[model samples]
Target: MPGRSPRRSTPQPATCRTCWGGSDSGPAFDAYATAWEADAKTLTDALHELADKIRASKGAYGGSDGLVSTQAARVRVGDGTVSTMPAYAERPSALASY
Candidate 1:
């Protein structure tokens, strides 16, 4: 990021001549980004499908309990102290829904 090239450089030229003649580079960049976006979107869709299949086929360790529950505790070790956030418990009233 430090040495990144600025978006626009050179005197008030209408276009960059490196990609296209007459110093115009907008079209080249736009085309490249369009193709890249399409490819990335395709890969993202595939990954999502794989994740969904795995999720659907998951056993008891699915998302329902994937998150570990914890109870509040005070801990100290080697003169160091740390406070941890304990997981919340379902209120007694909520059990009636089962």
Candidate 2:
């Protein structure tokens, strides 16, 4: 990315009165500008979709439910059994259903 212009630069034809103004590579400039616009739009849309998926997946595992699931699993190593434990106990919540 060294020496590359940032994509946020205005997307205009080579002769549009900016750094590219008076340059003879007008067609090449137009091609780059058009590609940048398309790529920027695609990146924006993909980011929005990723954010929505993250928001939807929240809270599926946490608190007491998560702790119970972990404690039930056993791992064997060198003829020894080890069980997973939560780092901290789940806090009591008045709103929590028993």
Candidate 3:
């Protein structure tokens, strides 16, 4: 995200003209830099939006997990014990084929 931040010192048309001795390519370089800066800003904005969505989703998932755990704890098996699922790592035999 930092790398995609808009450059503060983007080459101005005047600066490009000076660098190129007022050559015809100066305008072209200026146009290219302007377009690139605009694209970078767009990308930065999109990334920020994506980060916000991810944070919101994370909070939602945490709340859902807690609710599910509470519900699971309330259910009892035939032995009157709380039933729980095993983690994938605890079931290596189930992944033997993979």
Candidate 4:
């Protein structure tokens, strides 16, 4: 529909009714794994890169975050159902530790 809005993404798992167990936010997430000590920086950098990719792909899938969101509207009218638009991603209320 012409007035339909796009879906948004939530950064934290809390909105999904769950909690994230890992710390891949930046370089420190991988640092927790001792075995990856040597490649800690590399691993976190890759993680950051992966996060970027996730955001990039979303814009094409009806998402507004410019990442994991879809690039276009995924809902079709006259399907007898309404799309549950995703909420926009917002920064955490407080800084969290891993």
Candidate 5:
């Protein structure tokens, strides 16, 4: 007995049921349900807010890309045979040496 550890008893289902007021329709169940619902709503609202931010960022990136493309289209570099000219103007070749 001096070298032996004390044994611990595990609670049965009845013991657990009794602790929660003995049935499903109890104060403990009601409190748990209310807290769960509140937590779910808070999570849903945060997700929606995050989605809106992502959409706005996507639109901003798209607009910036369009503006850059438009500006790039207006720039032109000359080939060795001619002086520099706008991209919209006619040139001997589409490629430039410098």
Candidate 6:
């Protein structure tokens, strides 16, 4: 035992049956469903906000004109520059495929 290393226990998987349609999933599923709805709402709200910002930027610059440049144009979003245009545009149905 002096030279032997201590054995580590196997880590348990962080999972809930109720959330993923397993046995005894009633209460767990309910709780997870509530949280899922809240998350979905938050994502939708954030996407809407981004869309509004893009629209405002379009008005300030010109529609599609500001996005296009002789050289590579980068749009600033917060502290970072996004090198693409359509990324800021809103497509509500885009997440529907998921």
Which has the better lDDT: candidate 1, or candidate 6? 6
List model 1 lDDT by residue over 52-74, tens digit each. 98877785566445454322233
How close is every model to the real structure, measured as TM-score?
0.39, 0.39, 0.57, 0.27, 0.48, 0.41
The candidate with the higher TM-score, 3 or 6, is 3
Model 3, range 41-65, lDDT digits (tens) per residue?
9999999999999999999999999
TM-score (C-alpha, index-matched) for candidate 1: 0.39
For model 5, the run of ten residues with the poorest summed lDDT: 77-86
Which regions of candidate 2 fall more than 4 Å away from where they truly are? Answer: 1-24, 59-98
Q: What is the per-residue lDDT of model 2 for residues 14-97, given as tens digits with 9 covering 90 to 100?
A: 337445555646767779999999999999999999998876675544455677778766543644755586557789998888
Model 6 clashes, total count: 0
Give the clash count for model 5. 0
Model 6 lDDT at residue 82: 52
Give the 10-residue window scoring lowest on summed lDDT in candidate 4.
14-23
RMSD of 2: 19.8
Superior by lDDT: candidate 3 or candidate 5:
3
lDDT of each: 0.67, 0.73, 0.85, 0.61, 0.82, 0.73
RMSD of each candidate? 20.8, 19.8, 15.1, 34.1, 13.3, 25.0
The 10 consecutive residues of candidate 2 with the worst lDDT sum are 13-22
Candidate 4 regions exceeding 4 Å error are: 1-38, 63-98
**Could you give the candidate ranking by TM-score, starting with the highest?**
3, 5, 6, 2, 1, 4
lDDT of 5 by residue, 1-98 (tens): 89999998887766767765676645677799999999999999999999999999999999999999999998875553654664576667656765
lDDT of 2 at 74: 55
The candidates, ranked best first by lDDT, are 3, 5, 6, 2, 1, 4
Please provide, for model 6 over 19-95, each residue's C-alpha lDDT reduced to its tens digit, 9 standing for 90 to 100.
36655576676788999999999999999999999989978777456457733455446667656656567668967
Residues forming the 10-long window of minimal summed lDDT in candidate 3: 82-91
